[model samples]
Target: MTSTKIIHEKKNSDMKKLLGILLSISLLLAGCSISDKNKDLSQEHLVLSTIWFQKSPEAKALFYQAFNIAKERVVEFNKEEGEKPKAVVVDLDETMIDNSPFQGKMVEEGKPYNPEFWAEWTKLSQAKATPGAKDFTLFCDSIGVEVIYLSNRLTTELEWTMRNLDSLGFAFVTPNNFLLVDETSAKEPRREKVAEQYDIILLLGDNLNDFAEVFQHRGDDWGVSVVEKYKNEFGRRFIIFPNPMYGDWEKSIYNNERGLNENEKFKLRRKAVTAF
Candidate 1:
């Protein structure tokens, strides 16, 4: 073939190859868009969890049981480790107060969590105390043990959080006792700060990460595995409340992915469930 013709043919071939690659990429993106569109994104999955949290007698019983056990553990700690000043660390959201109303609103509207709505919810300062939480904290205060609320809520929400606690008649609702998220969501640093001043006799939270660093950044099975490893400390050193609505456990189900759309989250959640 003539050299000019050969060069022209090669240029045509390269152009065709580039076009094929572009077509493949376009098709792949189109397929992904359609798949996401078809997947369920409504907050329907939150219904049962919200219902159980807001309406179930069993849920209330569990909270009361956990705090009752916590009281006993506190007495034990004072008897055994009475030499040092002590404190009890607690997570505010599900540990000391109920936010199921927020969850229920989401379910009712068939929408996922909206930061704006959540901010408004916090501003309202309407969350009620979980069963037995007030009594337990007050009991600790009466006995001279410090009650520190270490929560992941942003520092900006501190005022409303305090108002909510105060409205619920919580004892020791002071700025020094309430530590909200500042630099990071991890509680270890904040817990360490409390440890420096007082021996933390007990830790109360719905999520395992509230107690230790071991529970953070693990696989789906890591939560269960770590819990098993510390099984003996459940009632004594850890008082876990029920929080079926949302937690790190759900994040693990999605492989700890951040900013996953509701559709992607629903798919992972369904895949994580066992079926016959």
Candidate 2:
């Protein structure tokens, strides 16, 4: 080969090597991102999914602040010009109780949530209280505001839930107060029942459905329309707990169909994102 041709070939070879290294680094970083996402979004790595709960000091502070604010609202509402039976409705999971440990155990055991899986976890009845949850309930009880647990947890888990709540120092917990899932997960009927007796001054929940049934089976807007409709109620009468770990919001992008396989969900979620 000519000397010039030889140098040109060597330069090309060097450039190719550099490009290969850059491509490798890109793939490596992409792989790391995928791994972290799997840990966060997949059932197999459910414990790692809740890293936000364990790692984020802001989340802990938010819980404390949310409950404190709820207490303040309760006090204010009690002093309002209403003589009806006053009550504060609350969701159990991820709101009053921190079930991150249960999620961790399920992940560790390579188990996904099923009827049996949930029954076993609730039967253990050892979920810790969310930050300030106990105090918030206590404050409500002290002020004579009946604390009602309006959970989506099935009726079968009622006993376990009661035991768990009592163990966690939650006050005003009883069969009458803990309204479990009946014919529907909408919770509107149960909430209406509670309303029949007590004026629901506040509804505390992690998911939007806990507040109203309109959020159920919502579209890509993710109940944004309904929220806008009742925009004033939020942070006033509807105190929400942060629960990005899992909720209907994630399902909203994928049409809220739970039957979609993991890969299908992934595709839908990716498509739902906004990028420049």
Candidate 3:
């Protein structure tokens, strides 16, 4: 080969080697970054989701906004001519009452939900009312509209749940008005029972499942399509509060599977997110 051609070939070979080294270094750096991120995912820290729920002014505003719109809708619904009595069905936790304290406790302990801990929390009867919730319910009461508290809290927790609501000065805490989960978490039957007696003008809750059974246990989309399907009903007949701590929406991330360990859930949560 000519001397010039030999030198040119050597230069091309050197360039290829340099490029390969740079690419390998880049991959190593990316791997380190990912490892660092996962290492810091310790549950000891307060979850950002719970932090947003507990501290954000916007979160408080959403509750107020929901109830304010609900009050207006109540007035409008009452004016309409209907044979059945007007009623509003409200979920307890994170909807009519603030349960972020309980969620915060769990977050502090680096633990997930346990029925035993939940029952103990309920027995305390210390949860306060959500923003504008008490006032809106009182407004409904003044207008002669029945306010029914429909919650998924187990029947065993009924006494403490009632005590907590009563402590918060909520209206209609009686046995007839407060309905707890008896057999299943599906609230459709309880809703149907309420429908038999009242018009059910508005349903207020923090979770979509609180509105309808259709929103529960859907695929990985987490019922986003269902929410879009019922888009118009929001702020009209169904009011939703902000709750980032926990909900049935999380079930979709796990494919509705139970008994997943912390690491499995952590992996699933990371995988469920979209990344550029």
lDDT of each: 0.88, 0.84, 0.86
Indicate the residue-level lDDT of 106 in model 1: 76
Question: Scored by Cα lDDT, where does model 3 land?
Answer: 0.86
lDDT of 2 by residue, 1-276 (tens): 899999999999999999999999999999998877665555653454488885788889989988988988998888887768799999999999988876776666544567787777789998889889999988888889999999888998999899998987889878999899878877899999998899899999999889987767566577788888888888898898898677777767777577776678668868888999
The TM-scores, one per candidate, come to 0.83, 0.80, 0.82
Locate the minimum summed-lDDT window of 10 residues in model 3. 37-46
Better of 1 and 3 by lDDT: 1
Return the lDDT, model 2, position 187. 86
Clashes of 2: 0
Please state the error at residue 205 of candidate 2 in Å: 0.4
Per model, state how many residue pairs clash: 0, 0, 0
Candidate 2 wrong stretches, greater than 4 Å: 1-49
lDDT of 1 by residue, 28-94 (tens): 9999887655433378788888899889999999999999999998888876655559999999998
| Tens-place lDDT digits, model 3, residues 1-276 | 999999999999999999999999999999998866655554533478778887889998888888889999999989988899999999999898887777777766656678998877888988889889889878999999999999999888888888888888888878888889988888999999999999999999989988887777566577888999999999898998888778887888788889997788878888888999
